[model samples]
Target: MLREQGSAIRNTLDSVLSLSNQKAYPVWESVNSFALIKAAEAGLGITILPENLLLDSLLHKKLRLIELDGIDMENKMLAILHKDKNITQPLKIILDNISNVL
Candidate 1:
């Protein structure tokens, strides 16, 4: 998931380096957003993630952003529901919540 629509995350990092004229550095990868957030909040290291993932944390002053000037991107994800299966009220509510968040 670190790679956005098409390696956008990695591409974004490269672009940041190019723009800043900074030295190349290694980046740690995480399997999920929760892990990334936890590691970053624990002072492990900084990270670049979809802004939405860090919105609440930033609002509460739990995390900060390192601006990459001139960069603009949106990350998208898909959830598929089987058409053959009946969607119950609970499932509908869950799907609605997910939709609303995105």
Candidate 2:
């Protein structure tokens, strides 16, 4: 399934799955994470999501993690800022907090 119409996830899947030569699977696309989880719980289909997002469901036994042997399913978070932009006090504080937590 897909999230938002122009999701980077779609491109990611295309690259990972060699989508050009493969037949398309039926998709249940949505922009909402809750909807996606509910659909998976109902056995509609499996989805790829960040481990953090699946913690609750996994703890409750509502979802299972299936590790694929050859898939590079790493997710990363990046913070970008323009070199010319000033780092305000508030922004620095926020960034520091996030850095500490991470």
CA lDDT, candidate 2, residue 28: 73
TM-score of 1: 0.56
Candidate 1: stretches off by over 4 Å: 1-25, 78-92
Candidate 2 lDDT for residue 91: 95
For residues 1-102, could you state the per-residue lDDT of candidate 2 as single tens digits? 555545665555656667446533637777777788778878889876666667889999999989878777554557799999899999999999878754
Every model: Cα RMSD to truth? 5.1, 2.8
Clashes by residue pair, model 2: none
Model 1 over residues 21-81: C-alpha lDDT tens digits? 8734546655566777877888887777778889978998888888766666555567787
True-structure lDDT of candidate 1 = 0.70
